[model samples]
Target chain A: MSITPFNIPIVPKLKKETIYSLARKGSRIDKRKLDQFREIKITLGAAGKAHGSALVELGHTKVLAGVKIEPGRPFSDMPDQGVLNVSAEFLPIASSEFEPGPPDENAIEVARVVDRALRESQAIDLGKLAIIPGEKVWVVWVDINVLDHDGNLFDASMLAAMAALLDAKIPQHEILEDGSVRIIGPPIEPLPVKKRVVSVTIGALGNVFLVDPSLEEEAVLDTRIMFSFDEEGNLVGMQKTGAGWLDWDKVAIAFNIARNKYTVPLRALQGAFKS
Target chain B: MSGKKPPFPLLKDGKRHDGRGPMDLRPIQMKVGILHNADGSAWVKMGRTEVIAAAYGPREPPMKAMILPDRAVIRFRYHMAPFSTDERKSPAPSRREIELSKVIREALEATILTHLFPRTVIDVFAEVIQADGGTRTAAITAASLALADAGIPMKGLIAGVAVGKVEGQLVLDIDQVEDEYGEADMPVAAIVGLRKIVLLQLNGVLKPDEFLKALSMAWEGLKRIYELERSVLGSKYKGV
Candidate 1:
C-alpha cells in the first residue's frame, strides 16, 4: 500500500532509561492519557438517500455503515431469533494495503467482532423479528464500509453499525399463507430493540495504551483489544486482535479503562435515536 | 436469453412504458465532486439508477508487470453496491462486473489523453449505488464528468446512450425492463469531436434495418445529451 511507505519507521528497542522515564511520568507520545478517548463525531444519514446510514469519525479513522431490511426466512435452527447479517468491505483507496476483492482477514475479523458485539449483547430484540414463527422473519443486513483506515476500525465500524440500526425502521407487514407478502405501511409502534449495544477498541503500544489509535499508531501497535457493553454497562463480548503477546496485567487495565469509557457513548447513542 | 417474457410492456397508450416518447430519454441529473477526497468525482442519476465515479492519482506507475511507456495506465473499477439490487449480493466482484470494468476501461481509454502523464497511473472507480436500466451508460457519462472535474485534459467529453428495439420499435435510453425483454439492446459511446462511436455492445437479436434505425435514434439522442454535457461543463468552468 502507498501509505505504508509514508509511515513512521519502527523504532528499535528503546533504551531502558527512556522507557522508565516515560513510564514514571504516566504520559505517552501524542500527549494522550492512558484511558482518554479521542474525539468522536457521528454524522447520521450521510447517504441520506439510503434507507438508513451513518458515518462515524473517531478522530482520523472513518467508517460508514448502512442498514437495509428485507423479509426472508429465518434460519431453521434459530427460527425464533431475527437474523442479523453483517459484512465489512475495506475500500482499496482507504489504505495502501487494501486490495480489491473479497474482503481479507482484517475485514472479516472486523465484521465478526462487530457481529459478536451485537449478537452477544442482544442489542436487537430478536423475538419481535419473527413474522411467522417458523416460516418468515425480517432479516436486517448491516454493512460496514471502511472508507478510511487510520486505526481501531473495529470500534468505529461497530459505532457506525449501531447508529445505522437505530436509524433503521422496518415497515409493518402481513404475510399470507400463499408465501406472498404485503407491506402494511408504517408501523403503529416502535421496532423492538431489546438493548442498545456499543463497542470501543483500545490499542496497546510500547507499554502505553491509547484509546482510538490513529493510523500511525495502528501501524506501530503490537495488539488491539475491543470491548462491547450494553446500556446496563454489562460486558457482552471482548475480542483481542493483532499480533504479539500482552501481559494479562495490561489486559486487566484495559478492561478497567473500557468500563469507564463505555457508558459515555451509550448515553450519546440513546439520545441520538430519540431525536 | 432466459426465454421468459419480460413483465413490462414496451409501448402503452401510443407512448413508451415509462410514458416517454420513443426518442425521449429518462430524466438525467448529475452533480460534480461528491467524493470529498477524490481528485475528481461526479454522481449521475438517470431515471432510478445512480452512479458515482471517483478519480484518483496521477501517481507513479504501478510496479507490477503491466506498464505502458507512451500513455499513462488507466485502471477502472466498476462495482455495484450490495444493496443496489433487489437481492443481497455477497461482497465479491462477480464475473459480470469484471467484464463491465474491462469494457468501460477500453471505452474511456479510447479518448482520454493519457500521454499527458507518462510513467503514472490514473484510477477511476465507478460504483453503482442503484440499478435501473442504462447503468453502464450512466457510469460512462458520470466518469467523463468526473474526469472533466479533475481538470484532466481530454479531447472532449464522451457521452453514452443506448438504443433498444422493443415491439418492433426503436427506443432511446432503454430502462431495465426494456433492456431485459427488449428484442435488441445496442449501447454506444460517442465522443464530441467527430461524433464517432468509441464503444459499442449489443445483445439479443436485431435485423440490419432495426440496428440502423436504433443507431440513428441514439445518434439523435446523443446530440441532446451533448448539449447537456456542454452546459454542465460550461457552468462549472464559468466560475473559474
Candidate 2:
C-alpha cells in the first residue's frame, strides 16, 4: 500500500575498475566497440488486441508498446489535428528497484522523452487523423510497459513506441445523420506515419564514451546523453542525464555517433513492421 | 427461455458454431520461458484469446506485513489490456480482474510448494493481450507454466478450462459469443496429475445433472491441456 523510491544498486569496486580499464582499450564489458549496440529483437502485433503493438528487446531490456485510437473531441487550440498521449509504467516485477503503484518520476520521464521524440519528428501525421473539422478526431494513446530493466530503456522504449505506431491501423467509421461518428467496420487503414525517429544513448566515463551501456555499465558511468534522430539524420530531441557534464566537443561527437548508427535500430524497427 | 430467441443456432447437426464437437476444446499453443527479465514466463494462445504470464521471486517480500514465517506468499495480478476487448477497456484494474487474480492465486497456490521458501513472495503477473472469452482460464494455465518455468518447486502442474451450456447443449470451451449469450458458465482449475479441483466458479444457471456433465467435459479438456504443458516443459528443458 505504500510507495518506495527506486534505489540503484551499487556496483563492486573491482567491476568498476574493470569497466574503466576496458574503456581505455576501446572495448566494453560486453566486448562490443565504443559505438556498437547489443542484439535487438522486436516482435510486432504482440498485443493482439491493440490496434498496434510491439514487443522490443534491446539486449535483456524488454518493453511492450500498445497503441489505441478512439474518437474524441479535439483540443481547442489543435482542433485541426489529433492528439497523442504517451504513458509508461514500470511494472513492479520488472526489476527489484521498481515499486508498485502509480507511475513514478522515472516512468514519466521515459514517457515524455518518447513522446517528444515522436511528436517533434512528426512521426504520425496528426492532420490525417482528423475525422471532422475541429469537433472530433482520433486520439491516439501509446502506452509503454517495461517488463525488464537492463539499462538503455530510453532507446528500447522509443523503438517500441515507433514500431507500435507504424503497425497501427485506423478503424473504419461512418458519420451518422446526427453528425456523430460510428465505427462501422474493423480497422482498415494504416496510420499515417510521415517520419521515422530513432534514439541512441551514449554513456561517458571520464573521456571515453560508449553506446548502449548495460545496467552494470550504467551503475558506474559518469554521464550519458540520448539523441533522437529523424530519417534524414536531423536531430529531433536530446536528453542529457547523470551528474557529470559533457563538453561541446563530446556533445558533437555523441551526435555524430548517433547519426551514423541510428540506422541500426531504425532498420530493426522497419524489419519488425515488415514481418 | 425468457421468450427471447437465442443469438443464432449455437449448435447444428451435433456440431458447435466453431465446428468443434460438444467436448472438443479450442486449439491451444503454448511456449514457456519466453521472457528474459522474469524468473519464469509463458505465452499461451487458445483460439483467438492470447495471454502472457510472468513469475518472479521466492524473494523477500516488498512489504514487511506480507512476509509469512512458514511459507512464501503468492501474489497474483491479472490484467486485461485496454485493447484486449471489442470495446477499449480502461487501463485500470477492475472488480473482475481483482476477483480473477484472487482465484488464480488460490488455484496456483494449491500446487506450488510455498513452504519451501519462507518469508518470501512469489509474484505471478498475467496479461490478457487479446480476449475472445475464457481469458481467466487461459491466464491461469499460462501462469502455472510460468511458475514452473521460474523453476519453482511444485507438487503438480495445474490446468484450467471452461465449460458452459449454450442453447440447452453442454459445450466445452465457450468462445466470446457463447459467453455473452450462453445459459451457464463454469470455469474449473485442478491439479493435473492429482485430479483435484482447486478453483471453481459458476455463473448463470444449470441443473445438477447438467453441472455434472459440464464437470466431466471440463476434466477431459484439462487432461489434454496438462499434456500440452508437460510437452512444452519437456521440450524446453530437454537436457536440463
- Per-residue accuracy of model 2 over B128-190 as CA lDDT, tens digit each: 999998898999899999999999998888888999878889899998877776766677777
For residues A6-114, could you state the per-residue lDDT of candidate 1 as single tens digits? 1234444453344334534775455667566666778888875445788888777889999877788888767766788889999987887787998755676677668
lDDT of 1 at B209: 46
lDDT of 1: 0.72
Which candidate number would show the highest lDDT if scored against the true structure? 2
Can you tell me which runs of candidate 2 are displaced by over 4 Å?
A1-6, B1-240
TM per candidate comes to 0.49, 0.53
**Model 1 lDDT, residue A204, Cα:** 66
Clashes of each: 2, 0
Candidate 2: CAPRI quality band = incorrect
lDDT, residue A135, model 1? 80
All candidates: interface RMSD:
24.0, 25.3
lDDT of each: 0.72, 0.81
lDDT by residue for model 1 (B1-240), tens:
222366777798769988999989889888887788999998888899999998887777557444555557777878889998867866587645654665667667656788888767888888999988788888888888898888877777878888877776888998888876766566766675555455555544444445456667887877777778778778877888
Candidate 2 local Cα displacement, residue A157, angstroms:
0.4
